[model samples]
Target: MFTTVRQQGWVDGSAAITGITPYASALECLMHYFREQQTICKKCCHVNYNHEAIQQCKLQKVDFIWVNRDLENFSWFLQLLNDFENEQLTYLETLRANNVTSKRYIDFHFYFTSLKSNNQGMIGYAPFDLAANIYQNVSNRDVLTKMRTKTILGRPQWSLLFAKFKAEHRRTSVFFTGKPVMGEDIKRWCDQYQFMYYHEPYF
Candidate 1:
């Protein structure tokens, strides 16, 4: 369904950020945006070629997850999460001493009491959502300036898009593995849409 190039891919948010400067720069501000929620907002769950790495944090009863073993992308983000019956078994220890820094971790509280899994993904509070959320929550001069000139990596093509009311769709989760693997070639595996890209993190 793609004219140019549409291939399913995976992102090691942690590893992927190292190359893109703008993304890396914006990431700091994004991190401050939620103390860690920024990755959930900006970094993680990116469209193809612009994907990010992974992370985890403890949030009351809910676990702030980011890493999905490759193959999961072929389906859908919410489906992978909804399929999660237990965090204890589903939790991926990709980051070894991450709890203290992100202040987030995995647990049993799913927080979807009255809501069903399918519809629960689309709720938002608008006006407040803009100020509180860092992902594309562009506003006055300060934030826009930081977005454009933060200088850590490169500039995000968000402010102008936000100004014009346009949106970027999450397409393929593309990322270069950048290294060689034993069994499948990263590029070839990505083309094939295999694990690390579409795997079952849980059962």
Candidate 2:
């Protein structure tokens, strides 16, 4: 829905993209952000997120994330953003509870089951992976092709080898939800890989 307008990014350029990253759509920008974890909106792009700069809109008054609308309901996608923000807060609280100071949560990695060090990354999910029939969850719930992140277990989905082409439409993703997974789904994925935690939780 937010991909209707041309989206652009001024970012920490990688070899694949250099200077003035103009995303084909908002979803593309999201994919790039998940992979790079770098700032995506330095020049007032259409889609803005927690990790981005202050755009024309004041920070306090704007939505947690801002994306241009295009007659499609983005409630599910907005939920994704909310989850991302909530997870960040939870991580910070976890770190504080685990004897890490608020000013230095970055230096200490709180050992927990299936907890990511940072929550800026992304992951794709099948419809059933999320809900029985997610049609009831989203305005545009027609299944589409599988959409993935930049890495296997590194960051989000894919880059060169695991890339999803033209990652906007989530109307035919029966193979996968073509959208990022959230909440308990993330724990399932992290536990499956044992990538984000130690075998024994540490204090």
Candidate 3:
């Protein structure tokens, strides 16, 4: 069985980012992740003062669980995700958008470390997947650098690869509902997550 918990919570209103308004669907979730930067997991947290929160919405009651890209963290992360789901402690937009009709939107995935491995997480290859579509829209190394970042070993090389993949995936549909993300550093982060730009982009 499942239950609802009511307690104190925290939201970094000042730490807010711009993105799409919350829609209630997996497609919306995917689209929001690709378009907006509103309240992300990193800048938010849920607080409960009672055990009821943990006992509600067990993993068996939720949909799928996405593991991290790392195998070692996969199981642990799934359990953690389950705990959050059981407590109904997902993001506000995600909860409202997904729960209204399909309660299974909480499906978990992994952050893909390498394609060679079998392990996965909540969302894998998000950046690469997105880049593969609109890479050609990007023009020069300077613009790429201006758009993304210089973190990976081969910034120039990765940018080129990203561009190529995006060009191939250009036909993919994306909704630009939120604000436009600026800065090479921010763009780089979006690239890592597979978005050429984002509103209220995260680091």
Candidate 4:
């Protein structure tokens, strides 16, 4: 039998293990474990729909998986955590600069949940105004498609800006998720900055 690692934030029904075979590989086991945990969290949130609580559960799942030292799949979850934290920081900074209370601002949870459910990639846009507009307006399929198209069109500019941001934040470790093989430039960049490079196989 596959052992289930008990985590602090797990709810009763969400905590139970089922449908996962002992013969599954380590990566498959981790994915199954986290997927079940997410389902449990959603069920637990049915009463009050506490987004923060659900997010906490998700992070706890990542932490539990990380403790197993499964670097391959763990890296992707770590990147998700980093992205969420960085986005929240940007939101707070935007609110502070505008002299607005956080209560008046849109919660990052909404955007994040939408992305997760839709299997959408995070758009690391630095400008809070544009990001907010995209988040607030891209509630439907047509708008989401339009926004994605716009992003694709502006990829060149966004890439340059992201590169600059990485340079400025070189002290912070960057994790790249993909196949084990990395391009020469990326290898060189990480080596030059001594940034921690994590290569997670695409799942």
Give the candidates in order of TM-score, highest first: 4, 2, 3, 1
Tens digits of per-residue lDDT, candidate 4, 24-99, equal 2333443443334332235554212223433443222211111111223333433443444444454455446656
lDDT of 3 at 125: 46
Clashes of 3: 29
Superposed model 1: Cα runs more than 4 Å off: 1-20, 36-172, 177-184, 194-203
Q: What is the C-alpha lDDT of each candidate?
A: 0.27, 0.26, 0.30, 0.31
Sort the candidates on lDDT, descending order: 4, 3, 1, 2
Candidate 2 residue 175 C-alpha distance from true site, Å: 28
Model 3 lDDT vs. the true structure?
0.30
- The clash tally of candidate 2 reads 14
Cα TM-score of candidate 3: 0.20
Give candidate 1's whole-model lDDT.
0.27
Q: Give the lDDT of residue 6 in candidate 3.
A: 13
Candidate 3 residue lDDT tens string, 1-203: 12211110111111222221121133333334323333334455432222233224232222221111233423432343334444343443444554433233233222222332112332454565446335535642111222221112111233543454355443211112211322344356445646444233322
In model 3, which regions exceed 4 Å deviation?
A: 1-69, 89-109, 116-186, 189-203
User: lDDT by residue for model 2 over 21-139, one digit each (tens)?
Assistant: 22223334443443353333558742323333312212111011121212123334434433444434544454456565432111100111121222323334333334423543463
Question: Among these predicted structures, which one has the highest lDDT?
Answer: 4
lDDT score, candidate 4, position 102: 42
